[model samples]
Target: MATRAEPIRQLRLRTPTDLEAEAVRNVAGALNALLADTFALYLKTKNFHWHVSGPHFRDYHLMLDEQATQIFAMTDELAERVRKIGAPTLRSIGQIAGMQRVLDNNADYVDPDDMLAELRDDNKDFVQRMREARDLCDDSRDAATASLLETFIDQSERRVWFLYETSRRGDGTGH
Candidate 1:
């Protein structure tokens, strides 16, 4: 005998709102995309942390570990924000893989400087994405999301600065 498939229950959010449901949906979609990218970056950072080697091995490894932790920490916040707005969040790695825009580095070996440069660029790209999401929130009058994105943007900028400075050559001129 064939078994019947269970019906999927749709989320029934009851929060009263002055904004249109469409606007909330749009913002949640944007947040989900950002969440996927953040998870991808976190995994990439962890990969580097685990495999990084060279003269600055210890420093780079420790830094990447810290950065990965920070990126991982954002995933929950992003998901919760989407839920708070009456939307379902990513439910699986496959869903995140489908939504992510960040590039992955899977080579067996990478130069220390190359890793720093790549991460720096990735962080910069993440900042740009965050700003774009913040713009979406602003357009939708989503002050809460906009405010949270401001903090994320600041953190990403700091990460970019650290990576850039670390990757720079010590020519003594500080150029």
Candidate 2:
């Protein structure tokens, strides 16, 4: 009897684009990293949304839920951008975890103030990363990707601002 052939495990689709191969590769890599970090942040935000408890429980919970929803919204667009640029996108959660730079919070309990502070820092860092990715798109002459990054960077900046305000003490300095 003839041996059965194994199915192809890694399939690379060729999406046509005018951009150079190296440019596509670099932008896709950056976008994928951003995508991974987005996923990580979304999960962390939802975790806090679910576990948060304090005098401001309702406000904190609602804010986290909104932020998580916004973060999750980016995933599909990011992945599609990668494909549009003639490159492959993230395949699985393992791929996301491997590429993610945003730190995960697996703690059983985190103080409400601490949670806000942590998310603030994370959002700030994410904005910086998105700026870097935007710069990469600029260098590669990828206007579409750069434009998308601009919107995401703005959204992340707003998240950072909200997080900072929410976590601030009565003192205006927030020191």
Candidate 3:
């Protein structure tokens, strides 16, 4: 005899009494995209941390490790925020890859300076995306999400600053 298959559970969002359902949906979508980008950036930073080699290897490696940790930390918070608003969050790396705008580095060999520059540019681009997400939250009047994004924007700006300073030449002449 053939066994009967279990019925799939259909999840439904219990909309919060305080927030508008439409706004919550919009904010959750923006947060999911932001979450994807954060994951991509986190992985890239960790990659650089592991492969970094140069006279300043210690400094660059340590910095990337710390930055990767920070980026990773943000991912959970972002996913939780989406769930809190009664929306589904990212489930797999493929979902993230589809949503992410950040470029990946697959080269077997990358110059130390080039790695730093590439990461620096990527972080800068991330900040821009964060700003766009924040704006969406603001427009939706999702104060909680918007406030969280402010902190993220500040952290990203700091990362960009650190990367920029580290990549600069010590000599008076800038590269």
- Put down candidate 3 lDDT per residue, 19-123, tens digits, no spaces: 687887888888998999999999989888999987889999999999999999999999988888777799999999999988899888788889889988988
Clashes of 2: 0
**Reference-based TM-score of each model:** 0.91, 0.91, 0.89
Please give the RMSD to the true structure for each candidate, in Å.
Answer: 3.1, 3.7, 3.7
> How would you encode candidate 1's per-residue C-alpha lDDT over 29-69 as one tens digit per residue?
99999999999999999999999998789999999999999
User: Higher lDDT: candidate 1 or 3?
Assistant: 1
Q: lDDT of each model, Cα atoms only?
A: 0.90, 0.93, 0.86
The number of clashing residue pairs in each candidate reads: 0, 0, 0
- Candidate 3 C-alpha error for residue 145, in Å: 0.5
List where candidate 2 sits over 4 angstroms from the true fold.
1-12, 171-175
Clash pairs (backbone) in predicted model 3: none
| lDDT against true structure, model 3 | 0.86
